[model samples]
Target chain A: LAKTTQPISMDSYEGQEVNITCSHNNIATNDYITWYQQFPSQGPRFIIQGYKTKVTNEVASLFIPADRKSSTLSLPRVSLSDTAVYYCLVVPHSSASKIIFGSGTRLSIRP
Target chain B: GAGVSQSPRYKVAKRGQDVALRCDPISGHVSLFWYQQALGQGPEFLTYFQNEAQLDKSGLPSDRFFAERPEGSVSTLKIQRTQQEDSAVYLCASSLGAGQVNTEAFFGQGTRLTVV
Candidate 1:
C-alpha cells in the first residue's frame, strides 16, 4: 500500500471552495487514488476516484497530475454539512487488496 | 436489504469475555471487508472475504480474533478474551465486484464495542 500524507485539519466557511491535497510519493503504477468522506458516527462515503488526469462527479473533482505522485480533491460551494474527515487512499489493482486508512484530513466548516 | 447492515450497534463487554459481531452485506455483493476504527483515528483493515473464501486475514490483531463467512452472505467476527484495547468500532463493507474493478464498496453503520 502507498502511504499518503495530508493536512491534519482545515477550516473553511460556507459557500467557499475547499481543496485538499494528498501526497503519495511512492505510488505504484497499478494503484488508483480514491477519496472518501466520513462524518461523525458514520461510515466513510466514497467521494471521488481517479487514476490520472481529472475526474469529476456531482459531488467533487479529483485532479491527478501527470506524475501521479499527488492528487487533489476539490469541493465547490461547500456548506456546513461538508464538515467531515476526508481520507485519501491508494489501492492496488488486485482482486483481494485491503484498504489501509491513515489519519485523514479533518475539514471543519464554520458558519 | 438496501445497504450493508450490522447487528448490535453498541456492545459493552467485560475483559476476558468473548463477543461476536455480525455483518450483513448487500445482496449479490462479492467482496466483504472488516475494519477496526479507534476513536479519533482512521479505520484499519481487519480481514477480507471473497464469496465464501477467507482471502486475507493478515490484519487480525491477535489470535483471539477470528472471522468467518459461511455460505458467502453473512459474516461474523469473534473475539475471545477481549481486552480494553479491543474497544473500538467494527465496520463491515461490501462491494459488487472484485477489488480490481471500479466498483464502490458500501459500508454499514458499524458496531461500537466498549470493553470495560
Candidate 2:
C-alpha cells in the first residue's frame, strides 16, 4: 500500500482555481493516482484518475509527474458547493487490492 | 437500485447489542466494499467481496465484525457485542469490474451508527 500525504486544510475564494497536491514518496510502479471528493454526511465521489502526465475531467484535473511520487488535483472556478474533503489515493493494478484512505485535505471555498 | 444503497441511514445501538448493516450494490457490479469512517477521518476499509466470494477481510478490526455476501448481490455486515468504539459511519461501495481496473467506485450515503 502507498501512503499519501496532503495538507490538512485549505481556504480559497470563489471563482478561483485551487490546486491540492498529494505526496506519495514510496509509490509503486503499478500504482495509479486517483482523487475523490467527499462531503459531510456522504461518501466520497471520484473526481479524476491518471497514470502519468495529466488527465482532465469535467469536475477536476489530475496531474502526475514522471517520477509518480506526487500528484495534483486542480479545480477550476471553484464555487461554494465545491467545499469538501479531498482524498488522494494510489491504487495498485491488482484484482483484489485494498484501498487505504488517509486523513484527507479539507477544502473550503469562500465568497 | 440505481446506485449503491444502504439501509437504515441512521442506526443507534446500545453497548453489548448486535447490529447488522445492509448494502445493495448496483445491478451488475462485481466488486463490493465496506468501510468504517470516523467523525474526523477518512474511511477505513473493513471488508471486500468479489461476487459471492470474500477475497479480503484483513481490514476488519476484531472477531466481532463479520460480513457476508451470499448470492453475490446484497451484503450484510454484522457486528456482535458492539462496543462504543464501533460508533462510526459504515460506508458501502461498488465498482463495475475487478480492483485491477481503473473504474470508479460508487458509494452510498452510509449508515451512521451511534452506540450509546
Candidate 3:
C-alpha cells in the first residue's frame, strides 16, 4: 500500500474553483488515483478517478502528471454544500487488494 | 438501482455488551467490505468478502471483532464486549468486480456505534 500526503484543511469561497493535491511518492505502476467526498453522517461518494493525464466528469476532474507521483482534484464553481472531507486513494489493480484510507483533506467552501 | 444499505442507523451500547451491525449490499455485487471510521477521521478497513467467502480479515482490529457473510449477500459485523473506544461509524461497501480498477465501491449510510 502507498501512503498519501495531503493538506489537513482548505478553505475556498463560493463560486471559486478549488484544487486539492495529493502526493504518493511510492505509487506503483498499476495503482490508480481516485478521489472521494464525504459529508457529515453520510457515506463517502466517488468524485473522480484517473490513471494518467486529465480525466473530467460532470462532478469533478482529476489531473495526473506523467510521473504519476501526484494528482490534483479540481472542483469547479464550489458552493457551501460542497464542503466535505475529500480523500485521495491509490488502489492496486489486483483482486481483493487491501484498501487503506488515509487522513483526508477537509474542504470548507464559504458562501 | 438501490445502493448499499445498513441497519440500525445508530446503535448505542454499554460497556461489556455485545452488538451486531448489519449491511445489505447492492444486488449482484461480488465484493463487499467493512470499514470502521472514527470521529473526525477517515475510514479504516476491517474485513472483506468475495461472495460468501471471507478472503481477507487482516484489518480486523482485535479477536473480539467478527464478521460473516454466509449467504454472500447480507453481512453482519459482531463486536463482543464493546468498549468506549469502540465508538465509531461502521461502513459497508460493495463493488461490481473483485479487482480495484475494474469497479468502484458504492457505500451505505453506515451504522453509527456509540459505546457509553
True contacts kept of each: 0.75, 0.82, 0.77
- Lowest-scoring 10 consecutive residues by lDDT in candidate 2 chain A? A91-100
Candidate 3 has a DockQ of 0.80
Q: Which segments of model 3 are wrong by more than 4 Å?
A: none
What is the fnat value (0 to 1) for candidate 1?
Answer: 0.75
lDDT of 2 by residue, B1-116 (tens): 68899988999999999999999999999999999999999999999999999999999999999999999999999999999999999999999888845788999999999999
The C-alpha TM-scores of every prediction are 0.99, 0.99, 0.98
* DockQ score for candidate 1: 0.79
Encode model 3's per-residue lDDT on A1-111: one tens digit a residue: 899999999999999999999999999999999898999999888888889999999999999999999999999999999999999999888887767888899999887
The 10-residue segment of model 1 chain B with minimum total lDDT is B96-105
Candidate 2, position A109, lDDT: 96
Stretches of candidate 1 exceeding 4 Å from the true structure? none
DockQ scores of the candidates: 0.79, 0.83, 0.80
Q: Could you give candidate 3's per-residue lDDT for residues B4-96 as a string of tens digits?
A: 999999999999999999999999998999999999999999999999999999989999999999999999999999999899999999988
- Pairs that collide in candidate 2 are none
